[model samples]
Target: MILIKYIIRNHIIPFLFACVVLISIFLLQFLMKFADKLIGKGLETIIIVKLIVYNLAWMVVLVVPMAVLVATLMAFGNMSQNNEIAIMKASGISLYKMIIPPLISSILIAILLVYFNNKIYPDANHAARLLMEDITRKKPTLSLVPGVFSQDVSSYAILARDVIQESNELKDVTIYDYSNPPKVNIVTAKEGKIFLVPNQKKLIMDLKVGEIHESDIYRQNVYRRLRFTHHKIAMPADQFTFEQSTPGGPRGDREMGAAQMLAIVDSINKVQSSYQKEFNSKIDQIIDKKFNYKPIDTTSNKYIYVKVEQRLRMLENGFTDVLNRIEYNRKEINRYMVEVHKKYALPVACIVFVLIGAPLGTMTRKGGIGMASGISLVFFVIYWAFLIGGEKLADRDLISPFVGIWSANVFLGIVGILLLIKTAKEKVTLNFEFITKRIPKSWKSSDDEIENN
Candidate 1:
């Protein structure tokens, strides 16, 4: 009992460390990719933070399995390095027994992850998507350049001859207002100041020494001109404002839970079944018409021929429509089933990684983060490649959803079991020094000299 407790305790720190490092890496990449969309949008800090937090749900799902791999490798590798495995084996404790605790822990983790994927992940994805849409819809802070027209405000165009950035002032400003149809209004001001309201829902322009020219398109003779000392124009600035929206819409595959997706697939199956029956009936009707024989009067041969041709054309059109519907339903089923399987498949990877990591760690006999990370990266890449490829194939109806998503786990699980059996039978240690030996002596000398300097 004490030994099992010690073994499980060793994994805790490494798993946590791996999770933090991997999540940080994912977070940095996300920020770099989305900086352009978030910058200069004048969004509240809380909104941005919420967006990041929501997106972290998916990052956690991906990081946990990899962390399991890293933690397993580090814990076992360290024990092997310290010769604890040798001591334990001499005392009659086999590697298989040592694996029981971590394996059980991994199963519990996998269960929690499955719950997280089905409950929390889908909502987070939906919220993040909506938040991103709101951010992108918001225009940047209004910018007006000297001797250029600015149309940032809806239904209004303003041209400024000179703009003072420090004062937010404009000189020799000409405005074209198109909020009303058939009547055109042009306002020119000698000096103006533009600013957005506190709510950011309206833009107000204060004009001084301006003339308003109003002309009606329907009546050329109706022209009015007014000169004013001071005037103010309020324009809609809703596009510049950021609003938090409630989540309410149809979600895509990635935005739905496994149960929801399975339900959808079930419904699609029912629809597809109906479509198939309809298609088969149409085919039978066409076949019957094609094979049936009918008699016609000799004097009415021309009319009978025309009637037969029309009937054939109508039946052909009906067959085409039915076939198309069936194909569409089939595609929908494949797409939803793929997502349903994926929700469970990724969580199951936690168990698979532990199986693979334990054997590899025992063989390598190295506990350092560098070695563990390198090995983990290679395996993760292969796992992800299989997952992505299988998803694509399944979505296209090339493979079954169960086969597409579970293939990686099956392949890796088998390899892990075999390695575990072999390691139990014989002692094996992998030396990586050969890789260092391959480095050029000149390069090594340079590195040594640099270190010395």
Candidate 2:
């Protein structure tokens, strides 16, 4: 009972502390990326702060696994440094027994992470994404001072001598459109009434007694025209819903449910199937690209030098094509496999990280929080590198998705087992000095910088 309380204080607390610190650090970095947007949007300071806090929650949820690992290590490492672990061992406690509190703690954190990923993370992500879109939408309601024409979007300019807010009317309005290349046009209206398109986000101006003027700069010419009635200018389809290209947007594969993932895969497969004829036709054009020279039958007469050059060019082209196909095939398989397993693999990383972290901390026997964290970071970097390599292979279909996703976990798990054994036995870990001692005599001296200046 006493030992369990010590675990709670020494291990669990430190782990929670680490989680808080890591979440804050990550949140700051995330906020930094959108600092410009916050300013540009002219959002309320309080609102912006609230959004930051909300967004931080999502980051906290994602990094829970890492925090659990670091916290476990730091707590245990502290105990080891203070001789608490040594005392426990001498008191007939096994390393496995010492790990119990941390193991329980880890399971709790994992449950929270699963809950956060499914519920909180999605809500936070959605809010952040919506905020970004709103900020970037940039709808400016400018009050142009009579004669002063304000440049809105590129090629469109607006001016009003006077504006009536109550009636939503403009007097002495002028529009200059220079969107067309090598030409410019200006329209002047004496009176205009504004109309908002229903359910669409476009504002239409009905102008009366408007004179149109045109100019050609390259030819150094000007043309004048007149119109008595109303003209409708094209506006972006913000008011009305329009279909958008959906490669990966807010509702991308990452955020999708299981059904969505399957639907996307099926859709992509359909596209590939439909384009099968196109790919087959590519084979016929393949030979033409290979040979630089015209067909022998068409040319009839080819010099010996031309024949050699053509043959060499064909060989080079063929070599390039072969290399391209090999590279492309490898990448395609790698990506496909990695993506297929990502949802499952990433969440499970929490458990794997904890397994590796616990043993590593015990082995180091160093309690400094920063030092433990640094060690954890190094391990994470190594794990991340393996993931990146596997992902690259899986994305291109060069490797199976299952292999790509679990490869890092498998490698890290084996490492965890080895480290666990070493730490449980308290083996002298291999470091630089250990390796240095095995080097030739020329690499070291007894009196020269040997544990002293």
Candidate 3:
């Protein structure tokens, strides 16, 4: 009991410390990239804080496994360096037994992480996505600077000579209305005020003492002119207002839970099955149409030929549509499958890291934040690289999601097993000095060859 407690204490402290440090580093990196989007947007403080918190869920998912690796290396390395492991082994405690507590702890952590990935993380992703979309929809505080063209509203551009910020008005405003194609419409207003109707998603400009000039290419020699004491022009504010995406409906793969993803995959499979059935039906219809042509004695060859050609073209188009649908469903399935496997695969990495880190720590026999961090970075990068590569291959349909997602874990697990066995059997540490000694004397460097010459 005491030994187990000691082992856990040693692992947990470093694990907690690494988690905090790594999560902070990752969050800072995320903020650095996304800060530009949020800054100068006039967003509320609560919204900004919520966005940051929502993004942290994914960061936690990535950092936890890395923290596990770091903690294991640091803990075991410390023990080995202090000869604690040697003493434990002398007392009939094997390395395998010594690993039981930390390994079990990592398993628990993995289990919790899996739940977090499936449940909490999806909601965070959804919220973040929605919030980001909302942020993207907001206009940049409607700053219509003097001598600058403002293209905030779609299909129209506004150029102002003087902008009075206090009254939210513009003087000597030239409005170019290009909503109509092949015609250039211009409105010159001595005074203008622009305001947005958020609910209607419309931008309205109230112009005073304005003259409208319009030219049509078709009527090259004619022009239309109109003058108004007060005129209001309304334009669609699609560019200014946030478009809520399919509200209260299903979300993307990353924003869905395991059950939701499974449901989506099942639906996609059904869609593919339906497409196959439709394709088969279309083939049958085409075959029937080809053979069931009327045997009219009075029908000319050209007429019959044109009819058959039209039927064949329709058949070809049907076949193409079916093929495109099938291909689309297949790609969709691959995306969902990759995401589904990723949820569990990433969490399992914590256990795989333990297997590798424990033996490596004992072998390396060095314990320090610097040493642990350096080694963890190398291994984690290799693992992440494999993961990203596998995901890409899976996405491209070159490999199954299972293989793409689990390959890293399987490969590293094998390596960990081999290392565990070697560690148990007391294998000698690799020595670079021995390799240097074994080098042939005749194999000399360029400097040595120059000296000999």
Candidate 4:
């Protein structure tokens, strides 16, 4: 009981510490990419903060598995370096028994992480995607400078010779309106002011003392010129507003919860099955028609031949349509299946890492941030590389979703088991002497430096 408590204590502290450190590191990297989109947009501070929080969900999902690996390595390494493993083994305690407490803890964590991924993670992803769409669509707060052409207003180009910044007014403005293609309108106004209509996606441009030139491609030889004392042009505006995303619409794979994804995949399978059945039935009908044909006379034979050709062409087109629909549904099913497997696959990684980390740490017999970081980083890179490759292959239907998603876990688990066996038998060792022997003898040692002094 005491031994189990001690093991749990050791694992939990490092697990938490590693989680915080890893999350911070990942979040900083994320901010580097995230900041570029939000800067100079004049967004409210609260909105920016909300976006950051929402994006943290995916970061948490990725960070937890790596943190488990780091924590397990550090904990077991510390025990091995301190000779605790030797004492436990001398008392007839097997290495497998020693792993039980931490293994159980990792399983529990994995289970909790599975819930998080399935329930909470999808909503965060959906929210972030929607917010990003809104942000990209929103126009920047307009700042027009004198003697510069402003194209910020939706699809209209405006050039002002001078501006009254304090009054938000423009003077001697020349505008090119190209909202209608092949028909361009040029307007020269003595002065104008732009106003935004509240709650409506519209911009009102009030112009005073302007002459309008209108031309059309259909009327190449003719042009219309008009002078007006006052003219107003209303245009659709890209409002810088954040509206709540609407619900009950088609969502991407990443935007759906696990149940929703499974339901969608099942639905696609049913649809594709129906398409296949329909295609087979049509083929069977064509064959029966071909075999059952009869002719009453020469004229009848000619009519039958023409009718059969037309029917054959129609069947060909129908078969093509059915095949296309089936293919599309299969692709969608593959996409959704990949995501469904991911929800389970990623959480299960915590348990797999525990398997790998425990034995590798005992073999290394070193406990420090540097050692743990180096080993875990290499292993994680390989794991992530395989995961990404598998996902791509699965998406393209090159491999089954199950095989692609679980390939990393299977490979890593096998390696972990082999290492665990070697470590248990006390065969694996970190032989510093073996490594140092490969170094050139010409390299100066501490003893040689002392002799020189």
**For this target, which candidate reaches the highest lDDT against the unseen true structure?**
1
Q: How close is candidate 3 to the true structure, as a TM-score?
A: 0.78
- Tens-digit per-residue lDDT, 108-146, candidate 4: 988998898888888888888887767754442234667
TM-score of each: 0.81, 0.61, 0.78, 0.81
Q: Write the per-residue lDDT of candidate 2 for residues 126-227, one digit (tens) a residue.
A: 565655555544323333356678664456687888876546577998888877877878888888865546654665667888888888888675566867
How close to the true structure is residue 208 of candidate 3, measured as C-alpha lDDT?
Answer: 98
lDDT per residue as tens, model 1, 1-453: 999999999899999999999999999999999987887666789999999999999999999999999999999999999999889999999999989999999999999999998999999999999898778656532357788888877788889998875466889999999889888899999999977788878888899998999999999989999999999999897765668778988898889998898898888888888888888887887777763435477666676677778888888898899888887878788888888887788888999888888878988999989999999999999999999999899888899878988999999889888989988888989888889899999999998999799
- The C-alpha stretches of model 3 lying farther than 4 A from their native spots are 139-152, 158-175, 179-247, 281-290, 298-310, 430-453
**Residue 360 local lDDT, model 4:** 82
Better of 2 and 4 by lDDT: 4
Estimate the TM-score for candidate 2. 0.61
lDDT of 4 at 13: 83
lDDT of 2: 0.65
**Candidate 1 local distance difference test against the native:** 0.88
Off by over 4 Å in 4: 141-183, 186-200, 203-213, 224-234, 244-248, 289-306, 431-453
The collision pairs in model 3 are none
